[model samples]
Target: MFKNVLSENIWGRVVSEKEPVFEEINKIVESNSKLISKLNNEYHDHDSTIKLLSEITGQKVDDSVGVNLPLYSDFGKHLSIGKSVFINSNVMFTDLGGITLEDHVLIGPRVNLLSVNHPTNPEQRRGLIVSPITIKKNAWIGAAATVLPGVTIGENAIVGANAVVTKDVPANTVVTGSPAKVVKTI
Candidate 1:
């Protein structure tokens, strides 16, 4: 079903909602949403949750990774969680383009890692723009932070609580507030 519609290089691609390809994408999203709902509601233990996450990603999730319940992802297949990563409860990942959480990353509660967005132009608002989001190794994202599409959180960086990141964060820095600005360097 996802022949030309989805691929490894889907980043920066635009797909209109009117297109047939979008229907195929929506179908996958719907099916994955059901599994995500089950993961949120039924699986409370660590092993069971990781097992379901592995099923969602179509790969074996490492035993070293830890994730709390109520995790959400619109396109679960595009998410990559590395070893020693700890994800808190109620985190959301819109990983259509792809979202990579590198090893030893720490994600606080209610964080949103968005890798897909709609066009800014009103005429093209119905279309979706694919962009990848990468959280480098050992990075820490505070509670309720929202990382926008195409942004990369650098290694060992810290994102403050409720920060809205719209651009790439430099390594070993601390960023806070909307459109997140660097406040300190570690």
Candidate 2:
């Protein structure tokens, strides 16, 4: 099903407020829920966790890629994670739009990578706005960070703990605080 729906423009096409894309999102989420359930269940064997993660992402993950338990995502099919990525516990990906984590990226605990937003208009607030999130090679997102829709974490950039990222982060910089601002260049 994921292979069938995966197209270059399919994600972009699903953004219309009037469309039934939300229903599609629910279907995808429902299909993937079993996998995530197994992942989080104590009864399941731990050895096959990586295989489950690969299935959820719809991509082959490197042997070096490591993710802690209890990872969460609403839509996992649209996620693209690269080699040697390390994602800690309690990471949530609202991947209705898409999420790309490039090689060697490190995601800290309790981080939220949100790819969906709502319109400000009272009548339209329930409507979904979708956007892709990209974390470039070697980017590090610290604990409890919330990365909003359409943002990019540049290569080797660091987002400090508890920061709220709302824009593109420049390469080789460190950002902290709400609506994260560049604090230093490393």
Candidate 3:
């Protein structure tokens, strides 16, 4: 069950009365631009901040957590991660649905770690669908990859670049192509 913050929920809602709520949501993200940009400055000293974020997520990022990118989060729920994980640039996650990345995971650039999936029902889809996403330890998701909702990326799996993973990827396997399929077992 997800209890999204009011402003964060607006992105999932579109109603006349809720328009202001959505606007406020945008404002919160907008006002954080300076902080966001500064956060993206790879040259800045961010060990403390990154560690803080990892702590907030209930994840262990080990001693090497360095990268300059816009880290987005909602719900402020605890995200669990393992050690020696590398998260690259242009990574966007709506944790209103919760996201967990495990140890030794290598996430390439522009990887969209989505937690929400649209419902099959048209009306429900139009409203909103929320679910969590988990990437187990040693999972290497390639660049420009899009991982769908509620899917568990198994440990020691390799998801190829530009792949759209709509289902679970088995551990110790390599997968590519849209709606990724297993290429071979590692």
Question: Best TM-score goes to which candidate?
Answer: 1
What's the residue-level lDDT of 135 in candidate 2?
96
Q: 1-186, model 1: which lDDT tens digit per residue?
A: 011235334456677788776777788798898999899878468888889998887667889999877889998887888999999989999988788889999999999999889989899898889888899999999999999999999999999999999999999999999989999999
Q: In model 2, which regions exceed 4 Å deviation? A: 1-18, 43-47
Better of 1 and 2 by TM-score: 1
Clashes per candidate, residues 3 or more apart or on different chains: 0, 0, 3
lDDT of each: 0.87, 0.84, 0.67
In model 3, the worst 10-residue window by lDDT is: 10-19
Tens digit of per-residue lDDT, candidate 2, span 3-111: 3243334444335456565577677789899888878875544447778888887777667888888899888888888888899999999887789999999999999
The residue pairs in collision within model 3 are: 57-79, 59-81, 82-103
Worst 10 residues of 2 by lDDT: 1-10
How big is the RMSD of model 2?
2.8
Cα-based TM-score, every candidate: 0.93, 0.90, 0.71
Model 3, 101-166: lDDT tens per residue?
776788898888887555566555444455667898889999989888778899899999999999
* Candidate achieving higher lDDT, 1 or 3: 1
Better of 2 and 3 by lDDT: 2
Ordered by lDDT, highest first, the candidates read 1, 2, 3
Q: Residue 18's C-alpha lDDT in candidate 1? A: 82
